[model samples]
Each structure stands twice: as structure tokens, then as C-alpha cells.
Target chain A: GAGVSQSPSNKVTEKGKDVELRCDPISGHTALYWYRQSLGQGLEFLIYFQGNSAPDKSGLPSDRFSAERTGGSVSTLTIQRTQQEDSAVYLCASSLWMGGPEAFFGQGTRLTVV
Target chain B: SQQGEEDPQALSIQEGENATMNCSYKTSINNLQWYRQNSGRGLVHLILIRSNEREKHSGRLRVTLDTSKKSSSLLITASRAADTASYFCATDALQGAQKLVFGQGTRLTINP
Candidate 1:
């Protein structure tokens, strides 16, 4: 893809239900990031992947939050036992390289946990 | 935790006027970037100033960074209605792989 792509523009799930969000980063990009944005709040870092290395998952809010990237192209963010507080816009971004290059963002998936 | 904090949560200005927003961060950063979001859309990168740089400009956007004070500001000159959006400041710490820590953002409304 020419830019970062995110799936399921919007998702509404019952509380306690599990959900998965997908992100397709730009081709040849080596760094991918996930962020959560709540209403009137800044983006919260969730995870970061640099190539095939172990991801930086320090920002995952809880054990229910997990993510995986395969082939260094596509990634998935999984939330188990979702809570109402989990509702937010999940943003995915990709950069050609890490730390120095500019990043491009996806439209994001608005997750609404009922 | 949010490492950056933006001031004047909301600002309203008439078209053709200039708008300035300030951001403060806690830790030393390798670089700081500004982004803008319209309504519920994705963010668009505006400008980036490295720790070694003090100021940068792009079109009507001017950005300044004071690393000594751990603060930055974004200035939009001769704003237009299309410029109405939420602006955010993101910081990339010295030890991370560009994992950005963003501020709450400043909502700017340009009145016609």
C-alpha cells in the first residue's frame, strides 16, 4: 500500500467480548506503531515493531492487550475481554526507519465497546 | 503517561489572524513533531524540529523548540477556515525507536 492501512473503520462490540484490529504498513517501511486516542485525550502508545525484532509492548494497558506482526508487513492488535474504557480510536502508523524518519498514519479504527 | 502537554486546550480566531499554541514536555527528546487532525480523521504531520535545531518553517507554519526549557510552539500565520483542526505535539525520547508520546492537543477554530 502507498500508505498505512487499517481495517474495520469502526467496530462496536459488547463488553467482555474480544476484538481484533489489523494494520497494513507501507511497503518497505521497517517501523510500525500502534496508538490509542480517547476523546479529548492525546494518543497513547500501545506497541512498536522494528522489523522482525521483539516488539516494544511497554504501552499495552493490560494483559488483555496483545499484538503480533507477521512477515514484517501486517500487524494485528487483539484486545481480550474488552471493557467500555477500551473504546477509542486505534491508530496505526509506519515510518521508513525508526527514530529519525517522519511517520505516516492510517485513518484508524474507532472501537466502541458497549 | 503523557510526556507532553499543550496549552489553551481550545482557541478561536478570525480568518487571516495568526494562531499560536504551546507545548511542554518533561524529558529530553531527540526530536519533536507537530501534527494536525480534522474532525475524526487521521493526523497529518506538519513539521519536525530536531533537538539540535531551534526553529523550522513550512508554508504558513512556523515551529520553534526550546530544549533548554523543554517546550515548543507552533505558529500558523494568516490562518484560514481550512486550518481549523486539532494540533498535537509529539516527542520522541532519546532512548526509544521513535515511539511518540503525544500531548492532549489544542483545538483551533478559525472563524470566517
Candidate 2:
């Protein structure tokens, strides 16, 4: 793809339900990132991936939040037993390589847990 | 907790005026980058300044880094209404933490 792509631009899920957000990064990019933004809030780092391995998962809010990237191309963020506070926009970004340079972002997935 | 903080949480300025946003971080960084977000969706990279470099420029954007003070600033010259959006600063920690930590963005509104 010419740019990072995220699926399901918007999602509304009932509390306690599970939702999955997907991301397809630019070709050949070795570094990927996941971030979350609440209503009018700052971007919160969730995870970072180099290749298919996540080097930093310290930002994951809780055990309910998990993510996986395969073949170093597409990634998925899964939020289990979602709560109302989990409502936010999940963003994905890719860079040529870890610490290589700037990152390209996807349009993001807006998840609303009601 | 490694995230940075942006100053003047919200700013409003007229078109053609210069707008400036500042960011401060708590840890040593290998580089600092500035990004712009429109409509709160995707973010576009604006500029990056290496720790060793004091300043850099891209078109109408100017970025400066003060590694000694662990701070950075973005200056948009002759701002346009189209420039109305949120600006963020991200840092690549020098401690080998390759993840980019972002600041609470500065929302700049340009009035026509």
C-alpha cells in the first residue's frame, strides 16, 4: 500500500464485548507502533514492533489489551471485555526501520464501547 | 511516564501570524520529531531534529532542539487557516528504547 491502512474506520461495541482493529503498514517497513487516543486526549503509546517481535509492551494498559503482527506486514489489536473507558481511536504507524526515521500513520479506528 | 508535555495546550492565532509550540521531555533522547494531526485522525510527520543538531527547517516549518534542556519547539511561519490542527512532539529515547514517546499535543486554531 502507498500508506499505512487501518480497517473499520469506526466501531461501536457493547461493553464486555471484544473488538479487533487491523493495520496494514507500508511495504518493507520493519517497525510498527500502536497508539490510543481518548476524546481530545494525547496519543498514548501501546506497543512497538520490530519485525514481528514486539520489543516494548510496557504501554499496554492492561491484560485485556493485546496485539500481534504477522509476516511483518499486517497487525491486529484486540481489546477483550471492553469497557466504556476503552472508547478511543486506535492508531497504527510504520517506519522504514526502528529508530530509522519518521513514521507513517494510518487513518485510525475509532472504537466506541457503550 | 516517559511521555513529553506540550506547552499552551491550546492556541489560537490569525492567519499570516507565526505560531509556536513548545515541548519538554523528561529523559535523554536520540532525536525529537514534530507531527501534525488534522481532524484527530492520522498524523503527518513535520520535522525531526537529532540530538546533536540544534535546528532544522522544512519549508515554512522550523524546529529547534535543546538537548541540554530536554526541550524542543516548532515554529510555523505565516500560518494558514489550513494549518489549524494539533501538533505533537515525539522523542526516540537515547536509552535504547526505540519506541517513540509522544507529548500531549498542542491544538492550534488559525482564524481566518
Query: Which candidate achieves the best DockQ against the true structure?
Result: 2
Question: lDDT per residue, candidate 2, A4-44, as tens digits?
Answer: 99999999999999999999999999999999998788999
Clashing residue pair totals per candidate (backbone < 3 A): 0, 0
Q: After superposition, how far is residue A35 of candidate 2 from its true place, in Å?
A: 0.1
lDDT by residue for model 2 (B9-50), tens: 999999999999999999898889999999989999989899
- TM-score of chain A considered alone, across all candidate predictions: 0.98, 0.96
DockQ for all candidate structures vs. native: 0.71, 0.85
**lDDT, candidate 1, B8-91, per-residue tens:** 899999999999999999888899999999875588899999999999999999999999999999999999999999999998
Please list the Cα RMSD from the true structure of every candidate, rounded to 1 decimal place: 1.3, 1.0
Model 2, residue A4: displacement in angstroms? Answer: 0.4
Q: What is the lDDT of residue A91 in candidate 2?
A: 95
